[model samples]
Target: MVVNTGKTFDPQRMLGTMRLADVDRGTDASGNHLIRIAGKPVRWALGCNFDVWPWACPATASSDAVRFGGDIAQLTDPTDTSIGMYVGTNAYYNGIFFEEQPDGSHALTTDIAAPHYYADGSTVITGSIRFRVSYDLMRTDMGIPNPETLTSTSLAGAVKTPTGAPAAGKFVTWHDPDGGGFFIEASGFTFSRKRLLVDAARITPTRPALARTVRKTARRGVLVHTRALPRGARVTSYAAYCRSASGHVVRASGAPGSSVVVVTGLRRGRSYRLQGGRELQGRPRCVERAAHPARPSLTLRPRAVPAARPAPASRGRPRGWRSTPHGRCATPTPCGWRTRSRDSRMVLNDSSA
Candidate 1:
């Protein structure tokens, strides 16, 4: 029996289904004819299955009788629309696409040698063939309509979503002439790709400026602030560099779009050029080490007085006692030596003198 499996196949899930076309002769005389439902062409893959009854080649021989090679000749004639078989065999056209006829129908013919063979038995020794053709109604089998016919005001209108509207955070993307594609993001968040290429050329970036503040950290520190970015601009992070240290410039970074960056380990009285968005100068000072007082000193003066006589040279000057050229005794004064003091008169006596 022949069965057509195309009517019940699912286009979304199934590639295609096989349908029995027809047989060449015998009780089944159906022909190869595919009826088109819609005005669409079919791309089909064809195959043939042949079933031979009464296994024995000669009627008098038993079913197990050994059949010689070439007992059933191969099919001939290029225009033949029939399948003949003396033995069970299968034939397939592999997986190649063949478009349906302009009238939406497809047919195939196969040749068989001595198509009609009869033997003396209750069962006829003819062959029954089923030509199964597989065709896809979806996917590659169908062709897209002309693009010029499609019109829409927005992408959302042309390509609709199941929910009738795009979901949050979704975007409509299109390729730019420069290269990468850009999209209009739904949320208010700034998007880099969405920036109009023309706007880039028109909007000039203002000279970058920096604001700095002192940090009261254990170690001397400074905080550099960066200006906010322009509209539709995207920046991941900011870095500050010292302009003087070209060879080994110290770099400090801050989070994306952050206002301030911390820079520490600075010299007390030294100055630094901080360059984040722009170059700026900074200095660290110590104000807790400059607030004290002083002290006083006293000096004594000797008043004019009669010179004291020097001790005899032979006796030598008494130890620890020296005579001044002005006849004033110093330090270990001799006995009975008197000197006027700044506050009042004072006298000293040395027993050795």
Candidate 2:
């Protein structure tokens, strides 16, 4: 077997660089065994050939197996099945003893141990078996983590956060059960819910004219008071912003549903505007105007009243002229009725209301 107690050798360059040994036997055999040298583990491979010729008649073809163990004592007196790996070949034989039987031959190209494992190159073969041993060097850290040493925190702090917030889905964080700390995400847990804030199409914005008088405060700030909002609409939040030499700078934000918003840290000479965020529970009902008729306009006709009995000529009253209880004179005109009040004594000859 190849043993390197010094620097590691490159695998690509180490190809065809093995030290090989061949052993031929007919009985059971063991290839080789090794112990760790310095700090590096041993690396090895084995190839074998099994043959049963026609001349060895009447003898049944048996199997051969190979295995690795920690020590020679353990290999000699194996207690558990974990100590060995079985290798074998198959053959066909007639039930009758003298009948023809098929010959058996088995071959192994190269059997390499799993990564991160030491190849002890130990084996036992039976019945006319021949094998070769090839040895090389491998890096100690060339494989995945050992299963026996894995724990819950093995992948701790391995997750990375995205640069921007995702439009959908969730961000998951892992917690360390032993340390009671957050890992793989943010430092603390933040809980939030999606809110259907406001429907602009169904809601009206706050009007500046309806604002209350701004009251200045002692702390170089102003308390902006607002009047009652429109029906079904209320202020959700407020902010105060002022135009600076560069751009509009927001000074502060106020609590929800507050009529008086306190905006601080204002410059004395700069004008600041206070704005309120509004949401509508529901829109106000609108009164629609009456619909006009499709056809022509209507015309009203006065009913014909029977002509007042003509005043008697002998009484010296004019024709169709009569007096009522109020002492008002009524006469019939071609258009409609005509009346004369005593105060004016004026003639009502036109059909007017």
Top-TM-score structure, candidate number: 1
TM-score, prediction 2: 0.18
**Model 2 C-alpha RMSD to native:** 35.2
The residue-by-residue lDDT of candidate 1 on 1-353, one tens digit each, is: 22222432211111111222222221223433222211111212122123442111222212312221111122354322212211121111122232343323221222221111222224322221222211121111212111111112112201112233322222222222222112221222111111110011101112234554453322234555545333212334555554232333345666655667776544322334555542211111101111112211111112234335556777687633345555554556444343333345332222222
How does candidate 1 score on lDDT? 0.28
Best by lDDT: 1
- In candidate 1, which residue pairs get closer than 3 Å at backbone N, Cα or C atoms, i.e. clash? 75-111, 75-112
Q: Give the alpha-carbon lDDT of every model.
A: 0.28, 0.26
lDDT of 2 by residue, 21-68 (tens): 111111112323322211112222222122432213112112322322
Query: lDDT value for candidate 2?
Result: 0.26
In candidate 1 the C-alpha lDDT for residue 233 amounts to 22
How far residue 183's Cα lies from its native spot in candidate 2, in Å, is 54
